[model samples]
Target: MWTEGQDTCISLGVMVCVVLLTGMARVLVRRHTRSTFIRVFVAELLATFQLCCCSHELQVLNELRPDTPSWTLTVIYFLSLVHGLTLVGAVSNPCGVLEQLALEQMPVWLGFLKIFAQMFSSGLSRTFMVWVWSLGISSRHFAERSIKCASPIHIALPEAFLVEMLCSFIFHSTVMHFQEVRLKFRIHMQAALITFLVFAGGNLTGAIFNPALALSLHLQCFHELFYNYLIVYCLAPSLGIMLMVLMFIHFLPWLHNMNRIHKNE
Candidate 1:
């Protein structure tokens, strides 16, 4: 369904290709440079690159085949797969990075840096996307872009908050559980899980559990007041990250012990 002539299609291809190639070149250079700052900064850029790429690609696919559940799911699945396959551990969502920190996968300070990078990347990506599409503050497309913000629509504030928490918990828990799996299969599982969750919860709250991505949307797409957006989209998911950590730590030992016992017996 993606033709070569449309401006949207051209922009999507050009931006993704350029961003990916740039990131790849940086990674290669960092291999020799081996600087911590460079590594983390590039990592942040790569992750944000994927994050914003996913956001825009989703819009393109949705528009191409709007209201078709299968098509949308397929689009999500492919995008998630691409994220997984890329050698870079591109975590475009700040909530995801927080979950990583909870699992002790990365250092605290670097996590903060990555969050900033991701936020900046999201804004940059959105700006580029708007330019490509000829969207501006007064454009109808600009107004329609509010979906990026993860702000409440028909749902009330409390319900929106609760929904985000639950979705984040589900997503984080799944990631932790599958953390040890081989890469070949892990991304597929994650992609499937994301597709399932998005289908179920996307309409409710845009199904974004990433605080950084939400921040990008808030700034660029003019989401609701900062207070409201922070409360429902960012804070709720942050709590969910902590809750997932606790649940994992408490249950993981028991599960390991049971596995050990079964093997010995």
Candidate 2:
């Protein structure tokens, strides 16, 4: 009863379903076991999304600006580096706190390092997604341009990037706090205020603090052969670097000293 085109649609839907279900299962397993499964799942999901978004953006750009090379590429690459560094630093904060607690330790330097690593890790998560998405988009483009008529898919890169950033805020803000609570870190109004400020600042810079989102959205929006490389390698990385610097300021020497004392004991 289904036509050929309809069959293709069904297949795509099925694939998306499978991915979501798999991700859910991984989340549940991690919740129960407290293993590294959560980390792996988060990484894989982020990477795949980024690559797909990037691929689509690349396709979209080719159609929009056929002439002068758009500087979008440069912006996106720089963003990626900044995103990677900041995210890794932020996310690693919980892990550092945990490590400190486990050893009955408290070191300001270690705490700072942990926070830095976590933030950078977050950006790296985005980078992974962007690359994964890009690979898919590229292969699809190659097939369409080379073998058959090019598929015309309308992509909204900026919107997609914003959505992903919102998700990051939700996950990072609440889940991170939960981690702190479980680790028995003193929860204070000041901590909450600081966390809120950080999230707001991050979102203000660009909803997509992660390089992966930037790359995916950029690729989806503009895929001009001439400009594509610039966006991926340059613009994305720059953003990551900037983000890294901002997030690094959160680490304090006193925090590291406290952890070190406990760790040494």
- TM-scores of all models? 0.79, 0.27
Q: Give lDDT tens digits, candidate 2, residues 1-265.
A: 4353453343334334434654565456557755443444454443344333333343333333335333334323432333232233123223324434433455566544444444444455445444443444322222233222231222344443334344344433444346445322323332343334334432333233334334333443334532533333234334333333334323454577779999999
Candidate 1 lDDT over residue span 176-230, tens digit each: 7888999888988999988998888878887878776665545533444767777
Candidate 2 residue 141 C-alpha distance from true site, Å: 11
- CA deviation > 4 Å runs, candidate 1: 1-19, 135-152, 218-223, 251-265
RMSD, one per candidate, in order: 4.9, 13.8
User: For model 2, what is the alpha-carbon lDDT of residue 137?
Assistant: 35
Candidate 1 has what TM-score?
0.79
Best by lDDT: 1
Full-model lDDT for every candidate: 0.71, 0.39
Residue 221, model 2, lDDT: 34
